[model samples]
Target: MPIDPERARLLFQVISSCYERRSLILTTNIEFSKWGTILGDEKLAAATIDRIVHHGRLVEFGGESKRMGDSLMLGRQ
Candidate 1:
C-alpha cells in the first residue's frame, strides 16, 4: 500500500492540536513497533510517534473477551 506522507503529517498535526488541551482516547490492535511500517514513511511516522508518546500513556491491556456476556462471566471469576 502506498502512503501519502504529507497527509500523514497533516493528520498527525491535526490530532496533536486537537489533543493539546482536551481529552482523547485511542485504541489500537496494532502494537507500537509496527507503527512505522504501517505508516510507511519514516519521518512522518517518527514525528507521529513522538507526538503520541509525549501526549499519551501506555498500559498493558489484558486478553480480549469475545462478548459482553463473556465479560460478565469473567467479572465473577
Candidate 2:
C-alpha cells in the first residue's frame, strides 16, 4: 500500500525534526531500496533512509515470522 502524500510529508518532517536529536527505532519488512515505492516518493524515501541509517544500527531477522506461527496456532485452536 502506498502512503498518502500528506502523511509522507509529515513523516519526513518528523524525521527531520528528530534527526540526531532523538533516537528512532523503526521496524520494517521492506528493504531500504523499496522504501520509495512504499513512501510514494523517491526523494522522501531517500531522505528518510539517509537520516535513519546515518546514526542507526540495523538488526535483521532471517526466519519464519513469529506472528505467522502464532496465527497458525490460533487457527488450529
Best by lDDT: 2
| Candidate 1 lDDT, 1-77, residue by residue in tens | 43576766676777678666776677777876777777777676677777777878887677664675467656833
Candidate 2 lDDT over residue span 12-52, tens digit each: 99988999999888888899999999999999999999999
**lDDT, candidate 2, at 7:** 95
How does model 2 score by TM-score? 0.85
Top-TM-score structure, candidate number: 2
